[model samples]
Target: MLPDFRVRQRDYLLEIARLLTEELDLEKLLARILKIAIEMLAGQAGLIALKETEGWRVATAHNIPPAFLSYLTPLLAEEKVADLDVTELNRMLKELTYTASMGLLNGTGIALAAHGQVIGVIFIFRNYADLFSANDKALLGSFAGQAAVAVHNARLYGQVNIEKQRLDALLDSAADGILILNADLTIERVNDAFERIFGRTHDQLAGTPHAEVIRWARDPIGVPLEEAITDGWPLTPNATLY
Candidate 1:
C-alpha cells in the first residue's frame, strides 16, 4: 500500500485535475482551487487574492471572517510567503482577539505566471500548530502550475469575446457590404449589407468557400482577386475572393 501522505497527495491532485477540466471561468476556477486547498490541508479559513493593475482584489473567500479579511489583505500585499513570520502574525492578531487565535499559522503561496512573468499568487492558510510538510508544498505548487494555465486561457477567451463583439459592431455599422474570409479562403463573416446585396442569408454563407459564393453572382466571376502579383503588393493567399 502507498504511504498515507502519498495517498492524500494523489487525492488532491485528482481534484486539481478535475478543476482544470471544468468550464472556462477564471473567478470560479480560482474559488474551486482555494476550496480544494483548504480541504486537503484542513485549513480553517483561506482566500484567493489576485493582483490587478489598480490593486489587490479578493477573488474568492472561504470561512474567512470579514474582520480578518481587512487585516489579511494588506499583509500579503507587499510581502511574499517567505517574508511572513508566524510569531509576528499572532502578535498582530492579539489586538483583535482576547487570546492567540492562530495556532500553527501555515500558508502555501503559489506564484501564478504567464508568458515568463509573475502575474499573481495563490495563498492557502491554516490556523494550526502543525507545519506544512514538504509533500504539502509540492502538491500546492503543482496545483498552481495547472491553475495558471487555466486562468491564462480563460483570460484569452474573454478577450476574444470582446473582440468579436467589436468586430460585429463595426461590420453592422459599415456603409458598404463587407465579408471576411479565413486563412483557408472560407467565408468567416458576412454583414447585413452583404446578405441584403447578395439576396441570401449570412448564416448560409458562413464556412462556405468564398469562390463558390461569388460564382453564384450575376457576372459569375470565378476569382475576384486572382493576381499572382509581380512586386510587393502585400502577399496574401491566392486571392479566392476580392
Candidate 2:
C-alpha cells in the first residue's frame, strides 16, 4: 500500500487542481488557495501580493487578524516589488520576518509569473521555524502559476469593462440621433439627440421597431422617413428644425 503521506499529498494536489479550475475571480481564487495552503501545510496565516501600475498591493489574506492588517497597510502602500532585485527581495523578507511582532514566523514566498513576467507573490506563514518542506514549496509554486492566470484574466476583464463604458459615453455624446438596429431592425440604443429630435424618451422608444419609429415622425412634406431609411437613403440633405 502507498504511504499515508503520499496519499495525503495526492489529495492536496487534487484539491489544488479543483481550486484552480473552479474559481474565476482572482481575489476569491487567491483567498481559497491561501486557506488551503494554511490547512495543508499547518501555516498560521497567508498573504497574496499583486503587482499594480503603482506598486504591490495585498490582493488577499487569510487568518490574519484586523490588528495585523492595520499595521501592514502603510508598510505595503505603494510598495514596488517590480523594482526589487533578488538581493532586495531577500533582504526585505528577512527584515519582515525579524520585525514581525506576531511570533517567530517561518514563511515561504513564490513569485506569480505569466508570459515570462512576474505579476505577484504568494506567501505562506507559520509561527514555527522550518515548517515549509520541499514538497510544500513545490506545491505553492504550482498554485502561484494558477493564481497568475486568474489575475491576468481579471485584469483583462476589468480593462474590457472600462473600454465598454468609454464607448457608451462616446455614443451618448453624439449630436445626431443614432439608432442601433438588430437584424430584425429593432431598436437597441437611442441617444440623447434621439430623445430631443424625436420627442420620445428612451424608455418609450427602446425595443420599438424601426419602421414604427419612422411612421411616428411624419415630415413636413408628408414623406415617411422610414421609406428613405429602409431604401438606405438619407432622410434629408439639409438640417430641418422639426
Candidate 3:
C-alpha cells in the first residue's frame, strides 16, 4: 500500500493534470500551481518566477512577504534560469529568505521546462532545519513538469486570444464586406460592412450556408461558389453580379 503522503501527492498531481487542460489564463493558472506546489511540499512559502524578455519576474507567490518578493524579483532578474549559478544563487536566496523572515531557514529551487526549453523556476521555502529530502525533490520535479506544460499552454492560449481579438477588430473595421466561412462554407462570421450591405445581422446569418444567403446570377462561373472556391477559382479577381 502507498504511504499516506504518497497518496496525497498522487492526488495533487492528478488535480494539476486536470488544470493543465482546463485552465488557460496564465495568471490564474500560475496562482493555482504555486499554491498546490507549496501545499504539496509543506513549505512556509513558495513562488514561481517566469522568464520574460526583460528578465525573470515573479508570476505568483504564496505566503511570501511583499518586501521579500520585491527584493527577490530583481535578484532573479539578473540572470536567466539556465545561466544561474545554483550554489551562489541558493546562498543568496537563503540569505535573503533569512533576512525576510528569521523563521525561513531552508529553500530549494527547480527549473520549470517544457519542450526542451526552460520557461521559469519554482522556489519553495520552509521553516524547518531539515533540508528537503531526495524524495521530496523528486515529487516536486514531477509536479513542476506538469506545471511547466500548463504554463506553456496558457501562454500559447493567451497569444491565440490576442490574435483573435486583433482579427475581430480588423474584420469589424473593414470598409469592404467580409464573410468568414467554415470548412463546410457555412457563415462563421460576417463583418459589419457585410451586415450593413446585406441588411442582416451576424446573429441571424451565422452558421447559414453561403448558397442560401447569396443569390448568384444564373451560375456566372458555371459552378457553385463553394465548388469554385474549392477548385481554386478566381485565379485573378473577376467581377461577378450577385
Q: Evaluate all candidate structures by whole-model CA lDDT and list the values in order.
A: 0.67, 0.71, 0.83
lDDT tens readout by residue for model 2, 1-242: 87755665667667766765666666677787678767767788878777667766778888766776676655666347546643455457556764774447767788878778887777777887775678777766666676677667766767888898887789889998888776577887888898999999888987899878866443448444445556554545753333
lDDT value, residue 191 of candidate 2:
83
- TM-score between candidate 3 and the true structure: 0.86
Better of 1 and 3 by TM-score: 3
lDDT of 1 by residue, 33-148 (tens): 78887777777766665566554556788876777777656654554522434334333333333233543455556666667755556666667657777877777777677767
Flag regions of model 1 displaced more than 4 Å: 67-106, 215-223, 226-242
What is every candidate's alpha-carbon RMSD to the true fold? 5.5, 6.3, 3.6
Inter-residue clash pairs, candidate 3: none
Candidate 3's residue-wise lDDT over 86-178, tens digit each?
A: 445556667777776765467888878899987888889888888898888888988999999999999999999999999999999999999
> Order of all candidates by TM-score, from best down to worst?
3, 1, 2
lDDT of 1 at 222: 49
Top-TM-score structure, candidate number: 3
